[model samples]
Target: MLLTTAAVMSALVLLASGGAWAFTGWASGRLDRIDPFGALGDRPEDGPRGALTFLLVGADDRSGLTREELDRLNLGRDEGGARTDTMMLVHLNRERDAISVVALPRDSWVTIPGHGPAKINAAYSFGGPQLAVQTVERATGVRIDHYAEVNFLGFLRVVDALGGVRICLPEPISDPRSGLQLPAGTHVVDGAGALAYVRTRSTAGGDLDRIDRQQRFISALLEAATDTRTLSDPARFTAFSETVLQTVTVDDGLTGGALLELGNQLRSVSMDDVTFTTVPAAQTDFTAPTGESAVLWDTEAARELFGRISRDEPLAEPSPPAAAQAGGAAEEPAQAAPELIVPPADITVQVRNGAGIQGLGARADEELRAAGFNVPVPADNWVGGTVEQTVVRHAAHRADSARTVAAALPGSRLERAGELGDGVEVVLGPDYQGVRAVEAAAPDSAGSGGIQAATATDNVCA
Candidate 1:
């Protein structure tokens, strides 16, 4: 009798597992059928083997919201049309050891294939997901393996089902417009609060800062949703799946066995294994032909970064030694310039001699030259007595270059002198000589100087 009971229990377990699998398959299929944009209909043949890319879009439309939801959330002016406020490309590598989430700013200006230059979000409005996918693919040279678009209502529901998410706030957030009020530090955010947090863009850093927050929030959500506790709760999983299906429109390739297989492969990945980064952009205010302020892509850095993704390589981290190596050092032998990499030539560095000692500007200029900066003339702008810090200046249009320069000088404090362009200006503070030595030796430890060559080759606005 005991053996018979074990057999019956095993069969019941198998049946339950099979049932859940069937349900997920059905839900995924239903989602594919509801793709009003027909973005998923085109399946590229060149997709990486066992790898998947999902263009996850978060739309601002609240049409699907119930009257109570609208009232409770205080959503105003139910704009009947949809516009994607958030765009993320989620890459599941073949080995699943790493996942890359690349966020494309909604206000980014890109060529829309048939529609000339336009806001990236406009691609969806023009030709729906198909045009958006095409624009992204053309821009990044990475094909879209799958697609998923979620509305505001869907996002709120998912957050609610997850039993609230924990968010780390560096400062108190009070956005009356979005109805978000939260104290500083880490706090548990519910559905409405999560929505507001991800959607808020009025803070100091604007859209870039908001994207960073959204990435963090999504990371937390992924952790909670994939937790063993959440997975074990069949009722919660069913509700979550239903909510997601009802609101999300996915590509055909993302349905049925494809999605189930992808999910199974990703079951082991944790939040820590995922990395999210915004595409590098010029720190300039782009005035469109229509006089609208739009952001332009930092063509050089962004292209290299995306190329690495297309090749399944990890994103390059700043190597101080590599920077120093590219700058040239008498102690180290120069190697061959890296292939398929281009460094910008119009780099400018401003050297201010703050050291009380004489000839500090000349010395700093020499160090910069050794570190590969083209300095036209050294200036003696030592307004402060005894240099205490170093400042690097780059035009807002050249922020990426400033970041690259700052990375080479890791220990030195970086002050943004938003007055220079495609250039690096150095202020010789008290510790100028020490900082120079530290940065000069950076290239020795960085392997082959290939990464530096890559950075140098990257054009600011391409």
Candidate 2:
């Protein structure tokens, strides 16, 4: 939830340009820094050029708090190590004129670098921000250009500094651990209440539900923070900046000036320009080999979901399956016109194993041959690790062939890889079922089930 963070970041640009040199000078010292990507080797340089992605982590660390204040806040003993209670991938597509904020469930199962498969959030606990950044980049093939962390106290202070944020409650709820107790209705919650609202997992949908509420709160926070009252007041603006600067911990790439440039890029962005969604998941109560309950993502859908973001493509609502439709009448897709169709035999493909399943690459290669398509031998591993879905990528000139190859492989999504050489490149995800006969088209929608979404302009309720 970047309600306050987004507001602060977006408004910081204005402050930097409005002759707040003294404040900027003061801010340089206030903001903390950590090189989250240091151990990960030289970062990839060819990320989406016109877009920037930041990993915003809400840490549950209670360090640096006086005993008295901790007790007064009802905060229990400091959790020795910090774990991200909330994580969001904030994407700013400068060329596309859109800002996408995607919330990732902490409980989602993923492979940690050193540890085996575990909750995505555990990446932070296993090795702090570096591991967390690595985990996210591997899980979602999108490159993380920046990282930001805010602890419990920092979040509380930010909310308090802004005079609190308004939230609508569906029913009365009380979560002892988070110390959140609220009546059913729309109410403005203070720092503590805001923390509790976002941290509580006792509700119906558990963490998944909390994410929805966080997204809503972010919208409300941005609306209130950017309101005329808050922006027009010189004193309030300065105070808010001080609170944020002291709280947010960013990577080296997000310097004050870099942040201002990011803000400048997003200056034209509005509530209408902001869209929020969660990574698609298959199950929430999946039991890992270690017997720990974790969230299982819908691999195929999740890959396509993040792949689109990596390419700065618009995220549209998912279309329902033909079988799920009334009367089960299949509508042939219009986007796959005859001119856009290429015979499987006429297409050449290079298969890359992104699915972690052993021998999947070889199997996919064999399947492609059986389907009468030319497959390049000796497939390579998708850099980073496994993916959730099989994707067909091609250069701009091979768009029609990519679509044709996609049709041959059921459930595969097509992507344009400008850097790719001739022919289609198939990155098989973990969900690769065998290659099948080219069939009617998949639905035109860009997203699918288990993915929750809301635009800043929407009145989304948890």
Candidate 3:
């Protein structure tokens, strides 16, 4: 249905060092190519030595869908054109252990070389991938060594081939525009559902939330793609590989051997090594000379960000709190403050009925999900038996995530547990009331003073 995630994650998983173990030269040889950088001039200088940066875009091509399929999928009639629906930069550090998938907002206001200022996406509509690459390089000063684009198909095939990918939502979304309808909870979705999930932006934070969905789905797909069972099964891997080659069009220079070499370098990479974030914005709505409202990047912040990328460094470290900065000694953030790095949507939760009331746990689960917590599992009996007071128990390392949960339960007390792992557990007591809405910590509030970021290991879906 939609090829958004494959444009980056699958490429990162299947084409880069991870999927090349069984991938043959024949498979790489079959990939179609469009030289994205060949005709461009005044390109930016190369980035950090030994680092590889690839620009990936999802090409919303519907030519392959039949009339019935298009109608069924609700994809409009074919509009013959070259335009990308979304764009992302995939950067791999020199040793290839760490990677960052940075989302570039399509509506970012930027100069398009000869085209002057326009929405970043307009570059592709004007000159296809060539100008798109040129514009991005000109705007960010980061050299793109390779490019690959995904069309409208194969996303479904890959997800279906793997049975399905697991997804967890903090809030329920019902967007008719994208034909996505799902409740808030743990879900293992098939191909069609995956398409709808990635395409819908009706949720809160709009594009930012959509980026979160893509990152989550990508993590799930990559998780399935790397599982020993899927890799060992020749039929499944072959089918998945075929879909990847068919759906993706790479730059002529991104050859099979080149991919194999990079893929092998990143074999040791885990989901934790990959970070997902969006480009920081100074203004979300800037009026252009053409009367278009586009996003504006925070110049100074973005420069430092791109410099770090060019130098093959991780994201800028978050700043210390005001108190810590003043005292020169680090201290825990004031409790009950909305300063958590892991947003509520990213926090995994389990609801248990300790109040002894039938179905109370399920109600709490639904209420928590409605309040934007990821309740991956349904309500259940409390493990430690009944208690008089509601309590939030979590692993010590996950105190921030735990605080996010406690914020939803007005009077819930905090407890530490070693067995609960990374997720937080809530045991409802007689004092338990209804859930209250809680806002995720703002980016600036989180001390990044940039855009929010998370790894697959930290994201809710994974």
Name the lDDT of candidate 1: 0.56
TM-score against truth, every candidate: 0.64, 0.67, 0.75
Error of 1 at 141 (Å): 1.8
Q: Model 3: C-alpha RMSD to truth?
A: 8.0
Best by TM-score: 3
How much is 46 displaced in model 1, in angstroms?
2.7
lDDT string, candidate 3, 103-202, tens digits:
7888899899888899988888888899989988998888999898887776777788788888876447788877778886778888878888888878
lDDT of 2 by residue, 1-462 (tens): 212233323333332223343235567667789999887953444456768787888777777778886766667777577767657888777563677788788788888877978888888888999988888888888889878777667777767878988777744778787778887677888887786776677665666667666776676677766777777788886776677777777788766676555555555666766777777666778888989888888787687778778888766532222122223222224245233234566566878889877788888888888888877555778874776777776543345556678777777776644333235788899778888766322223422322334566452222
Question: Any residue pairs clashing in model 2, and if so which?
Answer: 299-388
Query: Taking the tens digit of each residue's C-alpha lDDT, what string does model 1 give over 1-462?
Result: 000111111111111223335336466565644343353444334556866566666656767767776766757767677766657776668786666667788888889878999888888778777787887787777777766666666667667877887676644678876677877567787878877777676555567667656655655665566557866898876665565556565665545665555555555555445655667666436899978788887676677666667777665542222222222211111122122121222245667776666877887777666766556666666554665655554333234345445544434544432222234555676655432211222222332122221121111111
| 180: Cα error in model 1, Å | 1.6
Q: Which 10 consecutive residues of model 2 have the lowest summed lDDT?
A: 320-329
Off by over 4 Å in 3: 1-3, 16-23, 287-293, 317-449, 460-462
Candidates ranked, most accurate by TM-score first = 3, 2, 1
Model 1 TM-score is 0.64
